[model samples]
Target: MANEIAGLVVIVTGASAGIGRATAVSLAKLGANVVVTGRRAERLTALVDDLADFPGRRLVVPGDIQDEQLAQELVNRAVAEFGRLDVLVNNAGLGHHSALAEMPLADVRTILDTNVIGLLAVTQTAVAHMKAQGSGQIINVSSIVGQRPFPHNGIYSASKTAVNFITRTLRMELRPYNITVSLVYPGLTATEFGQAKLGQSGGNRFGLQGIPAQRVGDAIVKAVRYGRTEVYVTLFDWLFTHINRLFPQSIDWILTRRS
Candidate 1:
């Protein structure tokens, strides 16, 4: 795995904190030159500082993933600086905790813009580069909620659902180019995601305590090495996904009881 990752140029978005940040550091530790992007300049700078002694190089591109120009710049800069891109991690995303009836239309659009549209913009740009390279990997950060939407998480769930479809479709489309598409569906993780969703961070909405963000980061590395199409950050998330598939009504009953 180290041999496969070493010398590869990888791009990670939403890298200011949490899973994105952890993934960037993890890959850098394994000798992958990493380009890290997000909306927080100070945090990104701090991340670069943290990686000062990493085996591979790190580049900080602080900006919103929703910016198309930024997306293009990420790919261009990765190629120009690192020579070529070998991997792209579409981890930049946000979610709001609201039901369709009460959620503002603007918030819905915002979630879709960041989680779905922004992911696509970067992916489209990366695909162009990766296709030309003939061998590349695209790892999309989705969520377990994508497969099973719980109450009060309609908008966020919908966006992740879209991510699932996008990843699945691209996996086949990019196969000919030797480009692998993988999806990481995380359950609740210790990140600012909860704060972004519910306007606060400490609360655990899933009943289960969130796992460390590094867990997802490690999963990303494994997925890339093995060419895995789908991964769940925790075993529980994987089990739940399967349970939902095998017994939709039973899972629905459990969700209703919990909700």
Candidate 2:
């Protein structure tokens, strides 16, 4: 408990790679006992190998967070490993992309299952314990698409958009209990997640995007250090998100041209 985040026990899903993995490492460096969950046991082991000297405690729980039973089990595993839970990073998500016309209902359902439903289940489960403790933080990972509707990725966009709305609402609901809810919208970053998860990607359709995954990881670190309601990792992205809000028509036209 000597590091910045020393005393907190944080759970990060989708921890096999990308933002989730980066977050686990970052939090660990800060002395937070971190529990990483993902489906791939090998990748989780590799992650532990990479962060061999983390300042804080590290545990890996390989499982699908999309299941309700698994979500509760995730919290149980964290408490069992770390003694208590102080933060829950809901980063386990899947992306689905395709033109609405070409999109299969099954693919869209999968996106909702992983992104929205799973997130809700985990958050709900965390709330019970956080409410009892009277303090905690829940960081929900969303995307730029949560704010801007992307072409050929209607389903993915909607799923993250739901995260945006839900996180905000939970923030208000949990405020009295001293529970902090935050939404992190990472525009674009160097993560194999996009290509590996979503069949059709926005990178090709929407040209060059945001910065590295560490930038988002840095933002997560900031959120953990000083609780925030919402955070946009990149300055330009933060600017554009605001701009899109005020000038929806122009942004829509720009997106149409780009797509």
Candidate 3:
């Protein structure tokens, strides 16, 4: 029998904190050799040290995934150090807020580049390794915004929408080689990811209570092991998004300050 994700070689980007950190730690606990990558070397080092007894090896490759070349190098390093790449968790991302009119082109580009293109760059290389292996799993960390546009979150929603689309495409495209793609769209989670600022403070204390990051990490572990197309970490989040589609502008009347 195959390893069933246990003792698998997994690569996780943006593993410094939030969902990425939790996911890396969880995968490690599941007997996976997880390669954690991010721009913050210190944070990565701390996580690496913490998971010292995580059943499998852990390595930290610090860098910005926005750089396509560096993205390739990340895969090379993981393959070189771990000897195989069974799963790639494209979790490195940032979320920002600003009215579309006031949104800086630079800011817009940053969101698109990091969330969209940056993810694609790493995923491209991951697929290459998986294809060679003849079987693998790619779990793209998306958002509830991907399925439905929410107030004060246009560009972020669009980028996630792109991720959602690409994930479905990858599933169909890679199926020939037995590669599976799982899109994990999480709702309110108590991570820096839910913050108003990128990896900063502020979260969804009002709309819907957030969940612990460990819950999502555990879910990813299950998805990787069982093979799922797309999953929402919370039922409420999934319901909220489905409602938003039928009533897009309905929430505008809520006039929530934080939006």
Provide the global lDDT of candidate 3 against the true structure: 0.83
Question: In candidate 3, which residue pairs clash?
Answer: none
Candidate 2, superposed: residue stretches over 4 Å from native: 1-3, 201-203
Query: Looking at candidate 1, what is the lDDT of residue 140?
Result: 98
Whichever of 1 and 2 has more lDDT, that candidate is 1
Residue ranges of candidate 1 with Cα displaced over 4 Å? 1-3, 198-206
The digit string of per-residue lDDT tens for model 3 on 1-259 reads 2346677999998899888999998888878899999989999999999989768898888998778787888999999997789899998888876566667788788888899999999989988888998988899999987887654567888999999999999899999999989999988777866553542243343666679988888778778877876888888877877877787767544535446
Question: In lDDT terms, how accurate is model 1?
Answer: 0.87
The positional error of residue 198 in candidate 2, measured at the CA in angstroms, is 3.1
- TM-scores for all candidates: the values are 0.95, 0.94, 0.91
Each prediction's RMSD over C-alphas, in Å, is: 1.8, 2.1, 2.6
The residue-by-residue lDDT of candidate 1 on 1-259, one tens digit each, is: 3338888899999999899999998998888899999988899899989888978888887778767798888889889998889999999988776556877888888889899999999999999998887889999999998999887778888999999999999999999999999999998888878766642233344467778999999999888778887887777888889989999998788777876
Better of 2 and 3 by lDDT: 2
